[model samples]
Target: MMLLDSIGSVFSVIALKPIIMLMFFVIFLASIGKSIGVRRMYVNMLVRIFEYGRQNIESVRKLQYSNLNSSDVDEVALTTKELSTDSIDQSSNSAKINNVTKLNGVVTQMVNGDTNNGNSVISRVESLILLPGVENCPSKNRDSNQQDEIETLEFNLSNCLDYVKSGMEAIIEDEVTSRFEAEELKNWNLLTRTNRHYEFISLRLTVIWVIGFFIRYVILMPCRVFICFVGVVNCVVGFAIVGLIPNKKLRIMANDYVFKHTFRIFCRSLSAVIRFHSREYKPKNCGFCVANHTTPIDVAILSTDHSYSLIGQRHGGFLGILQRALARASPHIWFERAEAKDRMAVARRLKEHVSDPTNPPILIFPEGTCINNTSVMQFKKGSFEVGGVIYPVAIKYDARFGDAFWNSSRFSMLQYLYMMMTSWAIVCDVWYLPPMTRNEDESAIDFANRVKSVIAKQGGLVDLVWDGQLKRMKPKKEWKEKQQEEFTKRLKGE
Candidate 1:
């Protein structure tokens, strides 16, 4: 009663924050109560911690345990040893470091869990074996066992860690040496590297574009507009005098010469957009190449990168310039949509093109249809019909460009072209799969499946089933299921 009365008197003397001070005392007491509850939580929490520690320690033990068991403490001392005298590769070293980092997480979890597990296990065991405050430190350990056991364990662990660290460093150095072997001069990975580097340099290009735009509007456009007006007047005057002079042939020649020169300049400029690359593959060649069908920009990407003659619909565009230029290039085997049902005629035409020895390799985007680049659409089997060898190519836009939101919408060709020209920094992958020879008995769908499998494996590029049409990037399980379903349907047709 006297102690309680004294505490109450002290509380009354306190000022504005009395409730806050009282709450703090309550929380402190609650924490003490929770500590009492920890024994109850130990079974589950300790199990998790133990699992983590076991995983971390397993790597160390497997790699270095023998060294530790030998009790060669000097051999176990990792710090005393130096890395390999042979110069190691930086990249391989980095990769090993990454692997080491993965181990770090396992180690941290191991240590944390081990500590927690140890505390929990010790607490539980102590309760069963000895009373906390008065328990005698096993009479033997009080003299030497405890100290020696701890030192031994520490030494074992240090050597184990050192061995793992050294092994990892060696792995990294070896990997760097392998990747940059200068012997294979064929820059097969040149495409991927260019895409990565292009991303870095794009900001500079954008700045130039922004500045060039201002310059174009301020200086070039007005002059071009005036030039167009003058050219129109001259043409009008020539047209007015045409009939009496009977000079139609001269006018035709003049027009032809002007357009020819203009075309050469345009092709040169487009080629410059992508640095010089030659992607000429023969249809008879034993390789496969796949493509994404979006806007005609997809065609330009192929032409600029690989120079493969494209096989597609005979569609005309502005000035008929693209159509004319591409037509002159061999392997531009075009067929109208109406010709699909006329299988014999279409196959015959394709066969002729493929038979030509002089013609460059034919490239096809079997999608036969364009979709929002957000997903890969189901492929059309037209290209599969001419099958000799197939190489699956996947071109996904890297994130440097806001890809998810940026494909051209609906039928807006102009906007689509503009968007592509400005922001389509793409990562193009060309995976050359071993050729699949035509089986006289194999149906087209089977061939398509073989092609699809080749592509899906390229980078797990698969169709997603959204609302109705198959959308791309559907989860792998679902994509595989859809593929199975498609296979069944095709078999039924066969």
Candidate 2:
């Protein structure tokens, strides 16, 4: 009895030690609750700080540009309304217009002989040309009314000197303001970085956060990697075996089963939590399913339950091999855009496949290329020409965990797969919209656009006017520079 009592006492002490330590830790955390309630408290504080900073900067900008006179009050009011309600783009446009109007008023007074300081039209033109950044300003003709007024005043033609002067003044003003605004933005970004650095340093004092970070990255990451590896192996082996099946009908059925299960396993490996939503109506025997192109993994997400014949472009490397196998297993279509004959054949194949009830619904991403998932680009007309009930599948990924956007130009297929596999679960929101039929008077392009609009609306994504091919074209210099500036700002934590 004595020996048993001693053993029980030792175990009790051991358990009590952990309890005591836990109590002490909880008390210590509570002591700091006034300054840091939780991890989320820091996030809220950071957001508040950034929001305050943005407001301050905007106020300063408005102060710098606030030069409205009694006569210009209406214009300023209009501009103020635009700035308040419209986007940053519209705000900048209003600013430019306001400046131009101001400069134009000054030019018009001088040109109308209201304030003749002995400066001739030619002298004014020369002065404008000599102004910094004005030499490159492209010349534009004035309105007919302005031209008539200049002629009535007997002012020399000389390519509408007054209009040129007004344009030059506007350009000069814009250039100066733009430079100042860029510098201000840089300062703001620097401030943001300094604040974030200080905040990070302060947060490091918390013991629990450091321990949590260590566990998440050091222990959890490796486990996730192992799980993903197992999933990949499972998929590869299953798919390979499916590829070797001799019978076409058996191969199709086997491939569908493998693909569905493999995709679910793969998603589980990444910890991706998928939620599927449909409206009151679901697509049945629709013959075709059109979806917004977000990433190549879209296929795995969309085809998890349903069997679909995929229509895609010719790919290269291992993906190309997989593509070929998939095409063979099912009645899928692959087209090379470079070959006109191939496109024609694909068009015919799509029509025939839709007509065949034995074949599954043909799934096509009419966008042709993956976008950033923020917007849906224009759809190609080829799929719409099939003239059948079409199901538009709108896919929106919650990128809070990790960005699912596959930037094809920047990353290869392997890189994208590795990215999705390594990240915190990919969360997807899939919407199966009502089946749509082409209108009697609608052209193929019109029908495509109509369906695209419905998907965009349902997905709560912006509908971009440009086609997918245009998105791949070289961007404008101004746009590239703007992107670089934004990247720099992000790096600085602005």
Winning model by lDDT: 2
Give model 2's TM-score versus the native structure: 0.55
Model 2: lDDT to the true structure? 0.61
| TM-scores for every predicted model | 0.38, 0.55
Give one digit per residue, the lDDT tens place, for model 1 in 142-256: 2354335534442243423333543454354421122111112111111221132322223443454355446435443333333333333333443334323345556434433
Query: In candidate 1, residue 313 scores what lDDT?
Result: 63
- Show where candidate 1 strays beyond 4 Å: 1-289, 329-331, 339-343, 402-409, 424-427, 439-441, 464-494
List the lowest-lDDT window of 10 residues for candidate 1.
125-134
Per-candidate Cα lDDT values, in order, are 0.41, 0.61
